[model samples]
Target: MGIRSVLSKPLAKWVVERQREWMYRPAEAQQRWMQRLIKGGQNTVFGRDHRLTDVRTVEEFRQAVPVRDYEDLKPYIEQILNGDSDVLWKGKPLYLAKTSGTTSGTKYIPITRDSIPNHIDSARDALLNYIHETGNGAFLDGKLIFLSGSPELDQKAGIHVGRLSGIANHHVPGYLRTNQLPSYETNVIDDWETKLERIIDETIDQPMSLISGIPPWVQMYFDRIQERTGKKIKDVFPDFSVFVYGGVNFEPYRAKLFDSIGKRIDSIETYPASEGFIAFQDSQTEEGLLMLLDSGIFFEFIAADEYFSDNPRRLTIDEVELNKNYAVIINNNAGLWGYSIGDTVKFVSRDPYRLLVTGRIKHFISAFGEHVIGEEVEKALTDAMSKHPETEVVEFTVAPMVSPAEGLPYHEWLVEFATPPHNPAQFARDVDTRLTQLNVYYDDLITGSILQPLRLTSLPRGAFQQYMKSLGKLGGQNKVPRLSNDRKIADGLMGVVSGK
Candidate 1:
């Protein structure tokens, strides 16, 4: 038997045991985690203010603490930044993850020592579980390339600050580091173009078996590797067997990515964010990712329809039902209270809970009351692009055109295509038809003549990448918002195209 198979057999069993325990007793597990979190922080400022010491039950906890976004916690976070300890957690955060903010310039999310294990352990568990389910552990015998951001960190008030990818890379297991690609010096390079070029030059001939990263950046790497080697990824690395991806939905990029790889391979999706590592694909047969119950995060669900209401009903893991879209709220070991992370998801299974991310709560368009969302637009585009087998969508974004002075309101799509469709107008019509079918409100608006069909503007090649570069958000966890209520991003995209 192969050494990898023998080594992985025991790990697979352990992972399965842990997974089953959580699946069978999720409520019990969650209850324990919540109690631990509250007890650990009972003496902190946030805890005492929210009556954490007196709160013994979920009901009491809910009644005492209110749902909050980043703004609500900014003051405490600021206190932490200014060298205060025990303001939110029991001690000062070991580091902070700096990410793009929705309402502000940048957001610094706390990462405590207690929370660090959740990130590392959960990431390890994902791979172990995938091996358990698929019996595909041979990849462990070869090098694994992580297309990640620079690991060079900055200091703020004695706490390290950097992208989550960089922070997580720092915590990669020592044994795995032996087989990981891209030297530390290469990884710490700040410029993406320079870093990518160095990475391609360094690892183009290595016997790589696994590749992991966000879809967009990974796609770029795949393109570069193919261009350099004049071969498909599978041809270059015959044992290339797995792809681990997160940070965005993979539906739109799936076909193109597989085409570049030149064969079907095992894929695992993870729902990880700057806030927390939420879920990962556990069972290969299932459609949705299995929610990580043992992780330090206590989860709460608010129905999407009621999220903006004055008092939205919050349901625990025990009470949430199947197939309902819910805005995810989390209270985690990282010292985030009842925080709304702005993500919306829908349950695809109930027994061993699993869910698919539907959209972002704030990323939607309702300028003319059509109430279109990210999922609707992505699904519409996927369906539209499916009709034309010869073409593929590289990157795109949609926004509402609410120019009353010019004409009636319509949707504008700025698309950058690697391979343009034969008929852009017909492609636009197909997208509109799919949107009309998916969203009844959008259908009504179109039929009622209140809104015209969504217009498609085929952007010059590399327009989206140029726009991202212009914003200094060119790579590493930065994705263009797919749907926006206002035309600010749309206008910016047009400006980029015009400049080109």
Candidate 2:
């Protein structure tokens, strides 16, 4: 037997046992989790203010703490930043994960000492579950590469502040440290291009068995690796068996990644955010991720349609249904209470709870009342890509053109193509047709001539790269928002493309 086979047997058994417990007693698990989270933070300012100590039931907890967006929770975060202790959690946070903000400039999300172990354990379990399900423990025998953010962190009021991935790098177990690729020196490099080059140099000849990263950066790495070696990735790393991805939907990048590898490779998707490691793909036979019921995060779901209502319904694990989109609300050990992470998800299974991330709550186009979301646009693009097997989307974003003087307002797509379709206009038409089929309001608008057909703007090569560079968010978990309600991002993209 291989070294991995011996070493992973215990881990595999543990994962299987925990998974069984979660499957058989999901409701009980969630209830116990809720109690733990509330009791753990009850001594903190936030918990006391929300009457967590007196609250024993989920309903009482819900009634006490209202769902809050980033704006609502800013004051508490400011208190934490100003060197306050026991503000949110029982103790001070170990790190503040700095993330790119939407309306605000930058957000410093708390990462408490208690929450760090949960993040590490949950991430480990995601891979362990894959190994248990697939009986592919030999992957652990070889090196693994994690395309993460720079590990170099900044200190803010005695708390380390950096990207989540960077913070995660520091907590990698000592056992796995030797097996991880791209030495610590390479991982600390901030510039993506330089970092990628150094990673390629370090890992090109290693016994690479696994790779993990967000799809775009991973794709870039694969391209460069293939370019340098003049061989398929599979050839470069003969032992490569799996490619793990998270943070973005894999459908758009799936075909290209496997094609570059030159064979089918197992892939696991995860729904991990800076706030918490929420869900992970546990079963290859299943369609969606199995919700981690005991992972130190308490989840509540609000139906997307009801989210903006005066009094939206809050649904727990027991109440959620299959195939319904929900805005995810989380209360975790990190001391965030009823915080809306702004991502939307749809349950694919109820027993043991599996879900697919649908889209970002704020990332959508509602101009002319069509109400198109990231899911619809991504699906539309996927369908369009399906019709043209030769084409590949390197990067893309969609936005609305409102009140155009010359023509009826239409949705604008700025796409940077790695491989252009034989018929670009046909591809655009296919996208529009797919959108009309998926969204009733969009169909009505098109039928009634209230909006013109979507305008396709084929961006010159490297347009997205230039735009990202301009924004100073060139790589490492930074991605182009798929859809924008207004033309600002699209206009910025056009200006970069045209160099005007």
Candidate 3:
């Protein structure tokens, strides 16, 4: 046998064992999973969405549930302001998880006992697989760093993504975690500078064995760690064993972050969202084994290729077809049924149920894995530039690229501005400051060594006008692609940004 196959034979067996264990769970077998999620998700099920307590039968719960966006539940959210419990599901909501969603902008995703287990169980299964794969779980038992959000919401009506964030951290067993941002009890705005100052100050003296969070932000922390502590983040945590990451592609961030740290750390991939915790890597090498959370959710897989089709095929966890890129649709015990949360994943294996995140099936950019979509970027860019008035940006596109040389490729700005900033470097700084406030992920990517320096490429005004002329795409539904990994798609955007 070839050398590679010989090495992989044992791995293949383990992969099979793990996958088989997770996938074949029938509806009846998922009783415990359902109960845990139902109990934990008290807020999501019984509270905001109103699907839980009313749903005694699985089918009634499934059908009566209308798929909802953050806006759909906004009025109900306003009622939860005075620490009201009647409007929300059982008990006072344990807390809010601040997270970013498609249309809701940044929202405070409500989490209750009913909702938290979905995240906890999925995270645990994924962690379990990672431990078996790397055998580094022992070291992880030490001080583990999870680089998530501040987990607080401005007590406003709009959905704050950070709320979901705080709720996740709060629910995690304190014994396994290290320092996190502004506490669940606090009402910090999640301002990038404020949050970093707190995290940096808090963690400066401590040592960590494992670190996990969005790739972009972690890269930023590496720099902040160096600036404040004088020692490279790598030296500070010499025995850093695991690098658990989710949200964005690590390929772009890997070289610089590790090479600069001048060490090797096992990287673990994770898949969680505002909707629920999805899947994660089983091993550093193996494609992520999707640990099906049988209890928390009943999954429906829609064909990724045929996603928007008139008759797209959907397969449930029990009926998922093998080897297909399926857009995930979930029937969360918390009451989300066939809800399309806008992610596209390809199935690597079905017997045990594992999936690979291909590209964004949504209009999102994970440049830092904070899951910012086209709207957020467009809005933030607009809001930031509004004051300058020196440059009236006509059109723009933002994307993350892997460098041809090394490290995460720098973000290139294709902006069409009226009176463009004469100095490229200074303009880049202004843009960076604005984006950081909008999404910590983008801010961190720019600050970290993992990504290249930001550059501005001003385009002419007539550019976007002319391109739209040729493509025959007269703007019926011409949504911009926020995270363009494909070079060709990125190149095409230059015309609009540059007015070429």
The C-alpha TM-scores of every prediction are: 0.97, 0.97, 0.59
lDDT of 2 by residue, 297-401 (tens): 888999998998999999888998888889999999998899999999999888768899999988888988888988999999999999999988888899888
Q: Please write out the lDDT profile of model 3 over residues 205-320, one tens digit for every residue.
A: 66566677765457666767777767766778776777777875555345447754668877778777766788777656556545555546666666765776766665556666
Native-referenced Cα lDDT, model 1: 0.87
lDDT of 1 by residue, 1-500 (tens): 45665688698888789679888899999999999999988999899888898999999989988999999999899999999899889888988999888796789999899999878888888899888877788888888988888888999999999999899999998768888989999999877778889998888888888899989888888888888888998888888898999878898888788889999999889888878999899877878988988888999999988998999998999999888788999998889999999999988887889999989988888888877888889999888879976677778889888874666789999887778789988989999999999889999999998898988988887788788888888778889999988888888888988884
**Which portions of model 2 show Cα errors greater than 4 Å?**
none
The lDDT for every candidate, in the order shown, is 0.87, 0.89, 0.57
Candidates ranked by lDDT:
2, 1, 3
TM-score of model 1 relative to the true fold?
0.97
Give me candidate 3's TM-score against the actual structure: 0.59
lDDT of 2 at 148: 92
Q: What is the C-alpha RMSD of each candidate to the true structure, in Å?
A: 1.5, 1.3, 14.4
What overall lDDT, based on C-alpha atoms, would model 2 receive against the true structure?
Answer: 0.89
Better of 1 and 3 by TM-score: 1
Give the least accurate 10-residue stretch of model 3, judged by summed lDDT: 472-481
For model 1, give the RMSD to the true fold: 1.5
Q: Point out the higher-scoring one by lDDT: 2 or 3.
A: 2
